[model samples]
Target: MERNLMKGNEALAEAAIRAGCKCFFGYPITPQTELSAYMAKRMAKAGGVFLQAESEVAAINMVLGAASAGVRAMTSSSSPGISLKSEGISYIAASDLPCVIINVQRGGPGLGGIQPSQADYLQATKGLGHGDFQVLVYAPSSVQEMINLLTKAFDMADEFRMPAMILADGLLGQMMEPVEFPEAKTHQIPKPWATNGTGMKRKHNIINSLYLTPEELEKTVLDRYKRYEVLENEHTEAETYLTEDAEILVAAYGATARVAKSAVIKAREAGVKAGLIRPITLWPFPKKEIVKASENAKHILVTEMNMGQMVDDVKLAVECRVPVSFFGRTGGMVPKPSEILDKILELGGAE
Candidate 1:
């Protein structure tokens, strides 16, 4: 296969177009703006529509509109921009619209910085919007993985009739790496519930999120939760390194996972039985793998580019069986491999 060096954000845009993305609606935000810019340059040639919406809120609603037509639509934004899109995201989820959302994360709280950070873990996994809903969230550690997972995100969003997200960060978005775009295969799934024209042969389908009656709303919510249960059982993914007989475990995702892998290597060279578990799916959250990895581990260190958002999920997964500690760098600061190695060694009683 031929490989090309490409920026992560641009690679993701090309991947989405190849994956059958028909429409893109997004506002420019640092780190993620490249993705939208690429789409603007390429989408029309691919027979797709690319519109830079007036704001993040408008962009997400545009995605919802496009998705209701039963077509692959997407939107991209950074941390604060994602916050602005949250309400529209919730509406899409409630309406059972399938769409892809790209979040190239940056420092947070309130427009913190343009540099990388994973502070949106809680927002993405726990409280994306003001509703009881979940979107499929994939965390990619490299440019190539970002391409692969974005394709999967489109497929899964269609399969489950809900939104899916690519949870990337500034580091991954801005960095360049060699990546291969495999021959594209058509994976567009059929949607029977779409509001597209019916050709007068079938009943007109309605796409809506509003239910005036309490009973109707309750029933709809319950049905959506059932689909979520099936999704949880079927599509959780994680990657483990050197955890077969390890005494210490480290949990991380996205760019932080790359650093954690290096730290694990250093610990191994020093004869400290340390291993790493990287979660590829942040929403369903690879809990089963975490439990298995924790079985023979003494302590688990959760590292991120933020102040310990994913640590809460790790603790829940472990069920308090092992000590779970957190080490992180916030405000656009990234944790160095040496820093993570020190934490691993300290957990291994080598420091």
Candidate 2:
């Protein structure tokens, strides 16, 4: 095992290289620009393909082109660039091509800010594209998860013949942390259930999600929903810190969770019985586990970097009588741990 103190962006690029990804296509975008730059410098030596496409649209199309050839491929961008890739993402999902799209999320709605934010949760899990298809969006809160999830993203894409996203934030992208690359197994790539080109084998198959007929489309949605249900059961993951006998439960993820962790510690120090629930997979959402906090707590505090995007999910999970409240700073402003602690204290005292 090798240990390296690398930034999350660098770790992602490195993990891609080690994951046997053969192509990387992306444009320069803040927070994630380092990932593209690193790929540009390393792809050739790694015997892979790396291109700085003219635009994110072009880049994701290039990803589509490579992935259709049955090779592992990827692209990275921030919020603005990801917007341009939306059409291409829809196409990839519709085609059921295997590929990875990394979004190191920033403040958004349009050109928001470069600071870290979890505001992309809705866009990633729900904003897959204009169609009824879904992308497997993985939210990595730490630099280590950035490395680990990249490999898992590639594997899942190939296994399910679907697109997977590593949804991160500026903090996870730019922060330097220790990560060890996992041992490689070349046969890890999924078999050709996905068409590289049928040639003489099994005839030509068009892997598309589009079905004009109502019945046909319903069947496709049903199949996709089944897969999503499997993901929910197998992939739902979360971390809890000190929820036993807690008066207030603070729920946060991505960079906000880092702040929430500190706040929880402080609240505990102050004897507030505050605790935290940090989600690792935002899509499967770990809602069941989070709701359990409400079973024992008087109130649940949802902190975020946007105007309460996650709070809605928290409320749904905790249900009405739990007194769910929201605290946030939009446009890239990250509230400090002390601020979060204060909010929790206020909520706890109210209870």
Candidate 3:
């Protein structure tokens, strides 16, 4: 297999194309603009459609349209832009449409700087939109994992008939690393519910989210939640490092996980029994893995490039069996490995 050194944003776009993405509709935003640019350059040649819509709202609605037609569609944006696209995201989820969303996150309460931050963990996993709907959220810590997971994001979106998000950060998006593409596998899922066209031979399939009758709407939402339950049970993913005899466990994801892993390794070398648990799926959240990884732990530290968002999840996952603490940075600032190592040492009582 051959490997190419590529920026994370470009690698993600290429991976989506390889995953059979047929339509790309996105507006340019800092940190993630390269992904849309790559899609624009390559999508036409791949017999796919790439359009830069007038706004993030337009872009996401376009994705909804393409998804209704049963094509693999996607859009990319940064943090604020994602907020603009949230309503359409809810529509897609409520309509049971399948599409991928890429969020190369930046700092933010409003139009924050274009530097890496994992502050959007709550938005992606909890409140992507105003509804009782969930999108599959994958957090990639490396450029290579970004490629691998983007492909899986598309597949899983189709499999579960819902939207999926690649929850990446600016550091991962702008970084360069060697990545190998997987052999292209054909997407073979049949979309019999698609509103493509009936050809007058069959009844038209309507793509809609509005249910005027409250009971009908409740039924539809309930059914979607049932699918979500199955997804949670079977699809959660996490990575654990040196956790067997660990007395101190660290939980982090995406770019922060990369830093935390380094810290864990340093803590171990310094004679601390430290471990790291990196959640790959932020929605399902790998709670089971975190629980198991922290079972033998005396202290658990949750770290992120935000104000302790994931710490809540980590605490809930372990059910306060072990004391949970948090370390973080925000507003486009990233946590350093040495800082995390210091926190680990403090938690391990090695300092």
Candidate 4:
């Protein structure tokens, strides 16, 4: 298939429809508005429902309602709106529903700027809700990957019977590129466990996770952990470049990763054995891969659009055997390749 040019947001919308997402509920937010707009126009043709909920909170709840009916539902919002949706997300997680959410992050700690930022790394990986639940997070660096990730997000949600998120930033959401869809395959159907209501030949089933009993809650938590273990083994994926024979390795994801690639090239030209390890799944954190990369590297440089979020994960993955460092810019400013390279040189690690 020839690659088709698409903006990241549009690509996600198209992928959602193709992946059998029949319900969409969302309110407008910058850097991701195009995603909803595309859905509004295309959903009808695709036999999907695209509803513009009155607010982020409403949008997320609408998704919860639709998902409880066993329909593939979705919603997209930026950081501030995402914060509002978090309350409902807790409910969705508590209910053990299957759905997809997209957070095209922007600068934030508040009504932060609507520009590219990696500040939400911890928020997405941590429990967004009050419970001991997890969100399957896909961190895509390009429009093509953004499209591809949405497809995978649906699959994971059905397989694990949990919510999955495509955690992209404004940069990746707004960028334009050519993307080719995966080879034709029938999108898998959700398990019969998915509720279609119980009035015919089946008994009624309730899908809420709100157990009042402490013993039941403990069992639920342990059961969810077991499912996550399956994900950690089967779904975690990452990309590594030039790691072999490289004494210095750069770690990053999304737009920050694209910037780090340039640094890797410059360091290589300067006779330094510098490489890159780009994580595609932020939740799983690619720990095993980073640990392997650490064994052969002397220094690991973690770069992000925020002060230091993913660096903490890198540090944990590598442990104290190797030195891990960080460089970043926050509040909507993306670091330049040359600037990151300068930091690498200053560390005396870029050769």
Candidate 5:
């Protein structure tokens, strides 16, 4: 089927509905408000629930309640709103309920601006909330990728029995592009542990984050980490470009990677060997792929819309084998291809 043009936020909303997402709970915030608005109009037509909660806090908790009942559920917001939902996210994580969350990020230290930014890298991949838990995170570079990720986001949540996040920026959310939706998932693995009301034939189920005994909590945490290790090994994904014989390797994600790829092409045309590695999944962070991509490179550059949040992860992956440098544009500003090329040239990448 031919694809249709759509804004990233609207595409994601439609994708979630097609993914069999039965419930959506969210509070409106800029850059992401269109997502909730789209859901409000379409979800009801699809026989699903679209709720505009009073606050981010209330919305996330409502998601928790619905997901625990074995229904596919979701919530979305921007940076500050995501911060408000963190506590509830941690609770959902601890309770092992499955749900999808979207963060169409904006500038921030505090209510920074409604403009596009990737400042929430650390927050999404690292310390989203207080716990040893890790959520699967996907960063989509375009509106089409947003649809693909949003559809898969629900299955990942259900398959792992944990929260999964679609980490996008305001640029992707606001822009429009052609996108195609895969057919609705026809078969889903049943979640027996869900707190569906018990009938007379079965025992009652409970879903809660509390662990009154330290020993019990310790065991639970350890078990969860074991599961994460397995997930990290199996799910890490990234796209590599021109790395086979490049001298300088650029690492980026989301919309920034698209810009970096343009610079890489320009560099190659100018007789400079440059390549790119765009991480598709952020949490299981394609570490080995990055290490390998830098094998023949003279230098590694990490570009972001934030002040180098993901650079730390890149450094850890590179393991000091090659020099790693960072260039960024914060406060809602995005870097252009020429700007990234300049940084590449400054790193002695010019041939």
Candidate 6:
């Protein structure tokens, strides 16, 4: 396995291609535009389709169509662009189509700034659209993790027959790091429900999200949740660092997690019993791991590159067992290791 120095966004594009993604439909948005550019330059040579759609909504719908036809498909966007694609994401969820979406986040409530932000945590974890549906969300802290997760995202999407998202920040997209791609994987079995030319042997397969009857919709929603439960049990992923004897725990994810981990090491070196629990999968959220890590912890500090979104989830997971505090940097500002270390020291003394 050889490594290559590449930007996170470009690494993701190459990873998608190696993962056998057959189509990429995306709109160019800052911090992530390089991803689409990479795909545009290379997809044709890989014998894949790369179309820069007119708009984010159009791009996502194209992904939906490709996935329904049983091909690996993907789309990438920033925060504002992701908002535009929400409707199509919901439709894909309802249709149970497999596709990958990458959201390299920027500050937002409405196009706030092009700088990196983790403000989309709530949107990605909670249903991003108008329904009771979930996308398996992976938060990658490093360029390597970005490539790794994007590669796995395709398989996860196909395995569950749903959309999977890579929730990255603008910083990760712009940073360059060494990454090794996994060997390309092939689908072992055929998708029988795919509407990829019936060949007259089987009846026409219908791919749709429209359930006209309320009862039918209810049943579909219930069934989808049942599958979500299975995913929760099987796909929860997290990383625990020096949590065994720690008195303070730092809960973070994505780029914030990288900074938090550095603070943890600094805090520990300064004689503070600090540790970190980084959620890799934001959807299932590794509640089991959080609870387990909480056993030896006295206080939990949730850090984010936004104004405290994932902190709520941390509180829910901790369940009043320990006090949860939040430290945030909003509007695309990233927290420094020294700042987080200071907070850890303050929390350590207070607790």
Residue 52 alpha-carbon offset, candidate 2, angstroms: 1.1
Q: Pairs clashing in candidate 4? A: none
> Clashes in model 1: which pairs?
none
Instruction: lDDT winner between 2 and 4, please give it.
Output: 4
**In order, what lDDT does every prediction score?**
0.94, 0.84, 0.93, 0.87, 0.91, 0.92
**lDDT, candidate 3, 20-123, per-residue tens:** 89999999999998999999999999999999999999999999999999999999999999999999999999999999999999999899999999889999
lDDT of 2 at 18: 92
lDDT of 2 by residue, 21-81 (tens): 9999999989789999999999999999889999999999999888877789999999999
| Cα RMSD, each candidate | 0.9, 2.0, 0.9, 1.4, 1.1, 1.3
TM-score comparison, 1 vs 5, better candidate:
1
Expressed as tens digits, the lDDT of each residue in 274-306 for candidate 4 is: 888999999877998988766678888889999
Judge candidate 4 against the unseen true structure and give its global Cα lDDT, from 0 to 1. 0.87
TM-score of candidate 6 against the unseen true structure: 0.98
| lDDT of each residue in 1-351, candidate 1, tens digit only | 999999999999999999999999989999898999999999999999999999999999999999999899999999999999999999999999999999999998897899999999999998999989999999999999999999999999998899999999999999999999877674887899888899998998998989989999999899999998987788899999999888999999999999999999999999899999999999888999999988899999999999899988999998989999999999999999999999999889995
Best by lDDT: 1
Pairs that collide in candidate 5 are none
Off by over 4 Å in 2: 184-187, 209-212
Candidate 6, residues 1-351, lDDT tens digits: the string is 888899999999998988889999989989899999999999999999999999999999999999989999999999999999999999999999889999999988797899999999999999689898999999989999998888788888888888999999999999998878766564524689999998989999999999899999999899989989998998999999999988999999999999999999989888899999999999978999999988999999999998888877888888878999999899988999989999999999833
Could you tell me the lDDT of residue 68 within candidate 4? 85
Q: For candidate 5, lDDT tens digit of each residue in 235-331?
A: 8899999998878899999999999999999888887889999999999899989988888988999999999998889888988888889999999
Model 4 residue 150 CA deviation in Å: 0.8
Q: What TM-score does structure 3 among the candidates reach? A: 0.99
- Candidate 6 regions exceeding 4 Å error are 184-189
What candidate 1 gets wrong by more than 4 Å, as runs, is 184-186
At residue 169, candidate 5 shows an lDDT of: 96
